[model samples]
Target chain A: MLLKLLIFPGFLFLFLCALFFDWVDRRMLARFQGRVGPPWYQPVADLIKLLAKEDILPTGVNPLTAAVLPMVSLAAVLTAGLYIPFGAFSTASFEGDLIVVLFLLSIPALAYFLAGWISTGVYSVLGGSRALLQYFSYEVPFLMALAGPAILAGSWSITHIVDYQSQTIWIALMQPLGFVLAIIGLIGKLKRDPLDIPKAKSEVVAGSLTEFSGRKLALWHLTMNMQTVVGIFLLVNLFMGQSSVFGPIPAFLSFGLKSVGILLLLSTASALYARLRIDQLATLGWRVLAPLALVQILVATWIGG
Target chain B: MASPLRSLAYLLPQLWRALKEGPHTVKYPFDPVELPAGYRGRVIIRAENCRGCSMCVRDCPAFALELEREGRDAYRLIYHPERCAYCGQCELSCNFDAISLSNEFVPGKPDRKDLGVVLVNKEG
Candidate 1:
């Protein structure tokens, strides 16, 4: 009970903060396109409404799966946040290797895949398969891209990575290839547009979420939104780690501002590009992105290592 | 192979031109490209030309027009932006040329209740 108490608030805080980031993302994208976006409170309002809405289950959906799937996704994402070193504070830390973070980060998609499959809906089955493939395609490039940063700081631990960045030039400068690839990979993992094949609205109806509605649907949607925030947070920590001095207002605003910039970049891409198909996405990852990322690793290792 | 090589040689300038040219991506958030003129967007209505005729009311694909008639003859119009598909059908059907599809896309809602676009009679 006590441990649950400890975990709950942290997860809640992360979820709420993630939603704020999503709102900022929409706002920036709106500004980018010369349109006024939803207000910052929009995400909160949306979640509230979605939670209050009727939960609709498709025929043959396992009630247990429906109830547990979203919670698991949310739990996994928040758990990673516990481990992730944001600026300086990591709720849990060990030797600072992102190996743990990488595995933990995979939880969201894994949960999404399981949810998609267990729903026993055709749309979800297709979505689940696509999702599995999608994660498979991007994880390699993401790992390779991250390897450059690890090489620079001589550590896989993100705190050390951040600390190392402050000491030297930001690793982004030394390993531009790695930085760019990582950003691309970040976009991929977030399942944002141009790589949003799994959740492709045009192809799969809500992709993995076609059968979900009401509170359960709300939780699932909420998890994805939070994952977006986490994705942006990870990117910020890696490339633009903590630019503000410590204080509630200033630290909050600065962190918020850094995240908004990332969100803006993400949303802009989302607005401009159409999503690639599953096979094309895979090909892009393995054939194109992998080679390009490999070049970065080669260069970073040769030069920095 | 020779034919392909010839084709490559012939296409060398094009390849060189592409290499010399810049990236295709718009430098967004900095250099926002212009939205096309006919881009489907929010609908705005000119109250002056908007006669009391209920043609647009019936013709709107979203059934977006709700005429709130006042003072027996005087009237008010409510346009639901959320429901309005921006299909340009309303603009096309409006004989008085009252409605236009503007590029301004409003996405936020202060309240779900604030759904209607109110057209109050400001005319003297």
Candidate 2:
């Protein structure tokens, strides 16, 4: 169990998968924009380059806080990975692990908030506040959307949800509205296009990341990418029935293919859409997605009951 | 609200077209770049036709050219690529058809001196 948590299907596997997914996102975005993207090893190269750079801490900022937040964010995401079922294996799961995963997933964003807050820069403060606001707006719909699957599966355990899907149809088909809501909520959570206000480069100058450099910056980037992997992993396990229809090898292959498909879907959406303002993002999350998610939960509960 | 949905409908077809068209970027460096007609890149000096005239040196906006006398009637033209703006003024000012611009734009050198091009009049 320790080996599974630390190595395969856990930290190492998720880390590598996160890097690959980021590459795919960048490559697809570049192709969409009529440009050649970086090579496949670009993410690894970037990480190495960042590590080699001199760590620069801004004045009037707590050096310890700045140094520790990135690791905290990364650890939070890696710990979240432990509960996620990849293909036929889950590293560590228990009753109500979904709640644990949900809580763990938010830690990185909170770390981002704290990092921004501690930076003592105007842009960082603005970005930190925006990040906190965006979190509040999206969390409600995101949780409500998850409730659809949990209600239908009758268990909060991720493994139980997957097993339920194997015995029945995938929850995505049953809760199409919930699936759409979840995707929208995820786009906001991931800070992708049409909802990428917090780190809007033109406005906030890299948002909360303005003060970060060197190894901290690299770890922050790694954490963001890992969040993408964890998000898609959760999406697949909860909505798309994972690995039940085939043998272990095929199940693994199918899981990979599904995750890639989700990544591509996100990339395509990001390429096609423009960034939204904070007000617009809030409205979409609160007025639109939240209500839709509530309706989905109600319908899912009615059907399940 | 409906507009976002409408844009999404418009985006799907556009995304499909982009995927079908493949990547629009050229594999530069590995594959040869397709330069347009009359593309002015680096300046080239024709030493045989050059009469050591200072018109090109004077007209160079970037002051990238220098005239040196190797001996009496033996003139050598020196070009500093680092200082060159590649504005084609030197190519246009030369009356002897001595200097022209080539389409080779990729400038690479191991040393600073390597960027300097020197041409000597062999007949002198």
Local accuracy of candidate 2 as per-residue lDDT tens digits, A188-279: 77888767888999999878889899999999999999999999999999999763668899888888898898888788878877888888
Off by over 4 Å in 2: A243-245, B1-5, B34-37, B68-76, B110-116, B120-124
After aligning candidate 2 to the native by TM-score, how far in Å is the CA of A294 from where it should be? 1.5
| Residue A31 alpha-carbon offset, candidate 1, angstroms | 3.1
Per-residue CA lDDT of candidate 1, range B18-79, in tens? 43553344655678557788887887878778886877888887888788776666787788
The top-ranked prediction according to TM-score is 2
The residue-level lDDT of candidate 2 at B69 comes to 72
lDDT of 1 at B74: 79
List runs of model 1 lying over 4 Å from the truth. A1-9, A242-254, B1-124
lDDT of each: 0.75, 0.86
Query: Residues A167-210, candidate 1, lDDT per residue (tens digit)?
Result: 76667777777777787788888888778888888788877888
RMSD for each of the candidates:
11.1, 2.6
Query: For this target, which candidate reaches the highest DockQ against the unseen true structure?
Result: 2
Q: What TM-score, computed on C-alpha atoms, does each candidate reach?
A: 0.68, 0.92
Candidate 2 docking band: medium
